[model samples]
Target: MNETTLPPDDFHCGYVALIGAPNAGKSTLMNALLGAKISIVTAKPQTTRKRVLGFYTGDTHQIIFIDTPGLIRPKYILQQSMVTAAHSAIAEADAICVLIDGARALERGDLLPVGLLDLLRKAGSPVFAVITKSDLVADKKQLLPMMARLLEFYDFKAVIPISAPEGQGLDGLIDELRAVLPVGPQLYPEDMLSDAPERFFVSEIIREKIFEQYRQEVPYATEVFIAEFREEEKCDHIAAEIIVERESQKRILIGSGGDALKAIGIAARKDIEAFLGRKVFLELHVRVRDGWRDNEAWVRRLGY
Candidate 1:
């Protein structure tokens, strides 16, 4: 590791779960802290579906970072599972990171963090608040009130203001995390990066591209599933299915002469290659699976 990313002590190690409302930049923060893209990120809310683990190894400590789904009230069985997974991380974690967007302010967004903090306090978990996107908003004065907003419900061990995308206040956040880490042996190997398999990441890459290219409910209704993964002597080949609910959504995804699908494939292929550090042949198929999100059994089968 470089001097800039160095951890405080060689002997500190612990599980720090990243918890927050939707689109609070937790995944971006985890990727930045680890100095790698261990978690996938997108503009849409609830981009993360499970407890993705990103292992960051320092000279002495290995921080097992858990990237959780954004906390929201469940409207369907899949959403309920997501919310459960989010809370499970908080319950099991040695330390908790409640991330929020500093530039957006607190009032405009959903206050799910308020309820989440109550659960954390009741469980006696040490909590820290990280206000993300600090670089977007110029007024530093808003930070005090933002911190106060969080403090009103529950006392945090530390409150860090950061722009995860711009890399602001990351040092302070890491320093605070290091101080809270318990003395223990590294949980994962030094070279090991993430717990998610290649297939899972492939699906996420496609989904991220959908979120980037599509608008509104189209992104929310879509889910990517890997149908085939094969390796040739020359290159790695992958076939993935993009599931949507309606035929109209299918038309939008495929576009004229399959242009839209091609764009998503190209973008996703680039990311897949970078993640695998090898040449990749990405093929995408868009299909309509009506009401898949609302169906509990289908959601579980799709690995959501």
Candidate 2:
């Protein structure tokens, strides 16, 4: 059935926003929860620059999880847009899961950012303190004091520790989230994983490959735009342009004899084909956009 079709009378549905700092595993958690990778994850901070929605449909509930950009003070137009997308998610959510990197918080001895805490206070939604990457913690005993420290800041609906990769605490987290959802019909089809189109995910797949292959500022400076997507009987033809800020970065991305760009293309094409479940003829190009990150129009045009 489609999204418009009504579900069983006892079904529950609502939006849940997964909010956290950069590298806090928000994307990982969403991918884990949905059992699909709608959002890209990388070691780099701010890998997610916009809101990605994943639909988790169960017999009893449908949780629409909004994976947001990491919360950070914006220094430029693009960053400002990222922060805005996160804020917008917070406002739209019925519940908010504040993901705290378990290992990182334990090392720093801080639970929540002062600014983020203040923002959550006014969010008008049930806030959940989710300690992510529990598998990384050497001493599980340390979590008690961490949870205590977290409570000292704000009253959380629940404090849950989870390792997304191990499937630890995922069931409990789902139960907690499902319990808060309002009784309603499904907002999306049970078979539908996400509302984002194929083209958007295609661009994201290419961008993720860039993030994986490049180092330092190259990945952050680069943005992928799908210039052409054509469906043929045998395979899909896709052409993408990687936008960078400077010619030097372009030279670096292309490398001597165009080796680097070719490597990215090869890796990206494999994943893209797997994602689409079809053969793909992929094309890649690099262009200099000169301070595109700071330019408001450029940032908006790039689909940030």
Best by TM-score: 2
The CA-based lDDT of model 2 is what? 0.91
Alpha-carbon lDDT, every model: 0.85, 0.91
Candidate with top lDDT is 2
- What are the clashing pairs of model 2? none
TM-score of every candidate relative to the true structure: 0.92, 0.97
The total number of steric clashes, by the backbone 3 Å criterion, in model 2 comes to 0
In Å, residue 181's CA in model 2 sits off its true spot by 1.1
Which digits, one per residue and each the tens of the lDDT, describe model 1 over residues 1-304? Answer: 4435544445789889999988989999999988888777888898888889999887777788999999998998778889998888998888899988776664475434657756887668788988888887777886887787778767889788888768888878777877788977666778998888899888888888899998897898888999999988888999999999999999999999999989999999999999888899988888898899899888999876
Cα distance off (Å), candidate 1, residue 212: 0.5
Q: Report the lDDT of model 2 for residue 92.
A: 86
